[model samples]
Structures are given as structure tokens and as C-alpha cells.
Target: MGKGILIHLQDVNESKKSSKLDIWLDEERENLLCDITSLVKIESVAQEEDPTSDEPFGSECKKALDQFLYISRRDKMESYNHDGYCASAIIGSSNKTKPEIGIWNHLDVVPVGSGWTYPPLKCTIKDGYVIGRGVQDNKGPAMAVHYAMKYCLQQDLIKNIRVRQILGCQEESGMRDVKHYLENEKAPNYSFVADCGFPVCCGEKGHYNVTFKSRNYFSRFKELSAGTAANMIPDEATAVLVTEQGEKTYQCRGIGGHAAFPPGSKNAIGMLAAKLKKVIGRDKNYLDLLEFLYRTASDGYGRKLGIACEDELSGKLTCNAGILKLEQGKTILSLDIRYPITVSGASIKKQLYSEADKSGFDIIKEEDDPPYYMNEKSPFVQTLMSAWKEETGQNDEPFVMGGGTYARKIPNAIGFGPGQDRDFSVLGLSEGHGNCHSADEAESVDNIQKAVKIYVNALVKLDQWVGKGMVNNENI
Candidate 1:
């Protein structure tokens, strides 16, 4: 029942430089940049063990929310933190009956991991780019949403609706932050997360995190450690190989990157795991497992290890041996696999365990994300696609991606804007140049403006549904 309305700016040139709400937004750009740069200073990486019973990531993430709330309050808007979890700020017209609209963005970012020209905690502006952690992934988009909403509220341009910007603190590791918010707070009517790429992201492939445990294999080894994060391909993995002789250590080196493009960087744990067979010659079974993994990496047809799957949306299955350790004669392996949309993680795990059983390697599932897909003609896709075209005269269709985002957490969610084709080329974001989660990762100023424009237009187009009362109660 949602309707779409298109509004072309009176002067595409001037409006492109400055929309109807431009003057207010233009005045606030410097302040907006300062707020986003400040948020990037907090390290909100998810951690397993807590220094105390209190959540560390949650508290660190709260600092970001506090900074944002401070900025919003200065902008003359009411803002508050949701139980030290997510943060919300709202602005609307006198139309109290206007349907509620939500612009969701997460403040928590992936670990600043390693290898950076500048300190990950410090935001540096150079060559017209803001370089730091969380610059691209969510912080940049979060700022864009902030500016868009601020402009609407200040100019009183939004009609017949209230818009809210929700900032989640635990989106990188999981949806626990948002989950807690939903349990204690009211849900939005219509929402879109600016957490993925543009022109549009109509489909996101399934994601699964499974820990394959093998026990009674290497009891002599006292300890083993590999990766700190599941989403990042481990750059270093060390194993304390033990036998009747003594414990020998083997260290593997590589670069950590998103699993989507794993070939550019080696999986250190994977390499070390493969070398385990060579280091411990008597363990022929472990050797076979190594051979299976190597063969799968070389060719996609390795069935002896149960680590292969094929699909069209995201192409083939990608497996990263992120964590491995041998203890109490038991080998534990955590494999992060992102499968294509057509395949199920359950089926993939079944095949893997079947092979492992034959080879005497026990395996188990740790996490799984069901496949998500949407047609280009679907309302979500078309609306975002139209926004992209309105901002830029290109008609690029929605596409799928291997990397997971908050879009996977919410039903019917799609990734929109903050990345443009020119920005891709200018910033050298053309696949494997190191942008997101990489050292010196930053966002371009031009892209920031383009993103603000796109988001504002999308919000406007979504207003029709709000006006019609079709989206007010729809849980997005």
C-alpha cells in the first residue's frame, strides 16, 4: 500500500550543489564532519571476555552514542541512549499523525585489527578524505543519515511524518544491541539501513559461522590460538604442535581482510593448518585434512573435506580457516563460510561432517545465516534504484554481495548509498585496493555529499507511504 513520489529539484545544478534544504545542511557540514570524526575515536570492536562483568564493547560504544547525542542536542533535537545500548534522535513537524520513519545505522565497527598508517583511534583528514577506523563501514553512513535528518528537521521540509535515526552499538559482532532495543522500545514504521553499497543492494547472500571441533587428536599440546575475529581472515595463526618428542611452534603469516575477497591475502591459520600435516608426519589423517583444504583452495571440487558449495547470487562458497588450536589431543577448527544464495548452510554442514566422519575429523556448526534475496521489481529495490537514478543519471540495478550487514538482521532490508562509481575509482575502492576495514581506510568528501542527497531523496520518496498510513505499523 506504500506509494512513491518523485520530485526533481528546480535547478539540478544549483540543487545538486544545494537542495531545498541545502542552506541548513551546508551550514552544518563542518559540524557534522567533526561529530563523525569524534565518533571514530572510540573503539567499539566486539570482544569475547570482559575485563569486568560489565560489557566492554557496549560501554565503549556508548561513548559514540554520547558524542552523537551531544551533537544532536546542540542541533536543538532531543536525543538519548537506550539503556546504554542503541541511541535514538527524532524530529518531526506539527503533524503528530504522520507515520513514523526510521533511518537505522550502527555505531559499532569491526576491530581496527592491524596495519594502519595512522593510529586507528585517531581520525586524520588528508587529500580531502577522512581516514580512520569506521570511516567507511558505518560511521560515514551514520553521519550522512544525521545530516539528512538534520536538514529535514531544520528546514521543516519533511511533510506528514516523523523521522528517527537509530544508532546501534553491536551491529558488527551481532544484533544484540538492536535486539535489546527492540525488546524495550517501539519498532519503526518504514526503515532502511545505510550499511551497504550503492546504487542498491537488493540481495544479500547467506552467512554462517560454524566452529568445527575435533577432539582426542592432539592432547599433548598445552595451548593453541589463531584469530581474534570471525569475520576477518586471520593474518596470523600459531599452533603448539606436540608429539612424543616435544612441543614445536609453527607460525604462519598473511594479511587479514574481509572473507569476500580472500585470495588477495593469505589465511595464516589456513596456511598453518595445512603445514600441520607436514610438521607432524606421523599424523597421516591430519595430513589428509590439510591436503583436502589445499586442494579445495586450488580447485573447487574437493569433497573429502566437505568445504565446497556453488551458487549464482554470490558465486561460489568461500571458506576461511580463521581459528585452529590443538589441546587435550583434540583439534578445534573454526571455519567462516559464506555460501551462495541457492545453497543452505545446513546442507553444506551435513556434507562437511559426512566427509569428516569418513576421515575421522569431527565437525560442528557454530553460526548460520539463512539466504536473503529480493527481486529488482520489489518495492525495496525499485525505491532505492530510483533514488540512485535521481541522484545520478545512471540506472544501475540492484546486485548481491558476499559481505553481510545489518540488512541481514532486518527483514526486507537493502543497502543504499554512501558509495558512488566515481568515488570507487577515485578512492581506488575498485575491489582489493583496501577500503573497508583496511589500513588508512577513509571516506571521500564528495561521496559524503552525494550520499546525503541520495538519502534525503529516498526519505522523501518514502514519505508517501507514511502519509497514506500504510507504513506506520509495519514493523521494519
Candidate 2:
């Protein structure tokens, strides 16, 4: 997402400069593309709880981990799988004397959504861009981080700590994979999650997950279903109703996006419910459940539910009725809410619980992660921003975003980039065609190559700071 610091471009007449590192980077471009393609071919979407299954996340996630490690081993790199939840590829020796640096990226992607000309699973290369489900949001950046490790090694740019790239399997659904990871292994001293924009992300908004189940089943409706993930806005919703004539099927379509940034996204679940409120004709059979959906899901903000709030640093509090279905003869709604950094999770819960109770829905599940913020004046952040400035000749500063990255959970970590400076319009794709959680997700090849250079530079800088003023900044 182009949510990072705004970049100031140089004059077109000033030709771009090239270094020896860039020359070597060009040679590895094909390898990088092959690595991304290998991982993206698998539809690694997170699935529901399956206690009987062998893998922790799901079968597809297991396959993703297997393929990632197999490629690393085939490339003569040391790789490890953490019980099918996460996988790691290591470069250089491990020494506890120095900090162990790590790079975090996720393997699992959101469900393949509607409206796509290109296949969602295949990594299609067209017009200098890699198009697929997970290419832009994660898989493409994951491979870019992997190549940065190679570049660091080949140029002898590392001496302090071994570089490890950790790929987790559940980022879109919930961060259960991260909890399992921290329990089994040690957290990296100073690391970065390559899942956001550049120069660096100093703050990530708090994420509050809430679910509501209706008090009673709909007496007048036959059935209803929509959405697959908690973090994506529902694009289409279907409802079958017992009308005056007979049972009729009604469908509602709206724009979808990642719930963290829901400005232009319209909730189809809310749209359908609002229309049905008028169509139900004072029957009162499904009035209670219908009113709840219409009030909360009608807009991107949670104003109707009285949970809306905002602050300057992290922007507004966004809510999405991502999942709607019938379970145990009751209507259920899953919401993904991202609140401001200055707000407290307890306060949000207090407001949300009161509202849900008033609206006649019981809270079944709640997951909360408080906001994470790093001082912009810190040496670690300055170093990351320095790397970006050096690479792009821009003097952009650090920024705060709503997207909750691993930095919120990992110690001394921040959201770095495969920057959003890439031109997705290169392929002439229309609007709604190139976002992370939407269909036809893509990232430019040239953009990823540039990211490799930035990561290598950042890695080299991080390695040099192992012994110096490494105080509050653990890795530094």
C-alpha cells in the first residue's frame, strides 16, 4: 500500500545512477522471479480450525511451508520448518555473542476474491509485473528478502549475525501462527516485517477482533452466507427470504478491500441487509437480526454501533463485517476493527461489548493486540530511513499506518518495505485490480528488484550496528 511517507521525485533529465551492486542484482533477477513463482503457485489461503488435520494452519499452508523449505535446501541454504506453522531460511553462522537478525514475511494469503481476468493462483508475468493472489501483499516481498540475504552474503556484507527469513502461514485470518512461533523459538533482537511501505513504519494501529451471534434465528429467511476472511471487506452477500409470493434469492455487490483501510470499500453484507429491511414488509420475523446487520455494516466506520473513534497518528477506527453466516440456527457476524494508536484496547472492548449487547448479539470471540509505536528519533529507525533515502535519493521521513504488522508482536521490530513506489498501472489494469486483499493482486518486477537493493543496504547497515550503541534498540 502507498501508505508510507510521500516520495519527492527528481527531475526526469537526471539519469539514474547504477552501482556494481545493481549490476549483480540484475544478474539475480531471474532467480528472484523463479523463487516468487515457485511459492505463489500454491493457493496457501488460511482455513478454519481442523483438529483432525496434521498441519497447524491447514493442508495448503503445510504445502507452502514444504515448498519454501525445499527451494531453500535446493539452493544450498540451511532451512528449518517449525511444525508446519512457519519456516525459516538462514544465511551465515549463528553466534549468540551478536544479535541474530531476522526478516518476517507471511506465506498464507487471503481468499481469492471476485472480478479477475488473470488466474488468481498462477504467477503470471505480463508487462513487467508479476500478477497473482499473494504476489504484492507477501510472497513477492518474501522472495525479495530472501534475495537480499544472498546479496549480503555474496558481497561479504555481513559479519555480526546470521540473517534469517521467517515465513509464517497465518497473517490474513488471525496471528495464531505468531503466538505458536514465539512459544517455540526466541524472538529476533532487532528485526523488520517486510509487509508495509517505506522509509519505515514507526507505529501500527491496534487490532481488535470481535464476533457477534444473533439471539435467535431468522424466522422469515431461508439462509444467508458471505465472506471468507476476517480482515477483508465482503464484496458479495446473498440472502434467501420467505417473501409474500415465495422464497426468493437476493444478491448485493459492493467494493472490497483490506479492512485496515476501508475508505472506498462498501460492505455488501450491510447493503443487502438494509435493502431487506424494506422488503421484509413489517413481518418482524427477522427484524431483530436484520436491524443489527444494517446498522453496523452499512458503512465502513462503526459510528452506528457507537464504537467509532480516531486520532492523528493512526487515523480512524475501521470496522468490517467480513464474515456473515448461519451457525447453530443463529446468525453470526465477524468484524475486523483497527483502532488508533493512542486508544486503549480495554476502552474499545468496553464500548464494543456494550453496543453488541444493546443490539441483541452475544459476543462469542474477542482477540485484541494493543498498538505498537517506536520513536522516530531512534537510531534503528533512522538507519532504516537512511537506507531508503540512500537508495531513492528522496528525503522521506517515517510514517504510522493502520495495518498491524508483526512489529506489534515481535520485539524491537518495525514495518519496513518492498516500498509502494511501484507503478501497478504498467499493465493498464483498471481500478480495484491491484490491491493486496483484492483480486488480481500484483507487484512490479522492477519494484521488487529495487527492494532487494534496499534490503541489502539495510542488512549491511544493521550488521554494522551489532556492537555499537545497541541500547533500547536491541539489534542496534
Q: Give the alpha carbon lDDT tens digit for every residue of 1-476 in model 2.
A: 01132122221321332376678778878888888888888888877656335588888888888888887887667789887778998876566555677799999998898887798888899998889988987999988888888766666667777788999998876777777788899887778899998889988988888889878767566778888887888889999878678999999988888888887678899999988888777755477678888877887788887888999777788888899998767888999888888888898789878877776789999899888999887777877787788777888778888887777888888899985766766777756667789878888888898898888877765665553334333325
C-alpha lDDT of all candidate models, in order: 0.68, 0.80
Q: Which 10-residue window of candidate 2 scores lowest in summed lDDT?
A: 1-10
List where candidate 1 sits over 4 angstroms from the true fold: 1-27, 47-57, 93-97, 219-224, 240-249, 292-307, 326-329, 421-433, 464-476
| Deviation (Å) of 31 in candidate 2 | 2.0
Which residues of candidate 2, in runs, are more than 4 Å off? 1-18, 48-54, 467-475
Backbone clash pairs for candidate 2 read none
RMSD of 1: 4.0
RMSD of each: 4.0, 4.7
- For all predicted structures, in order, the TM-scores are 0.84, 0.91
Lowest-lDDT window of 10 residues in candidate 1? 295-304
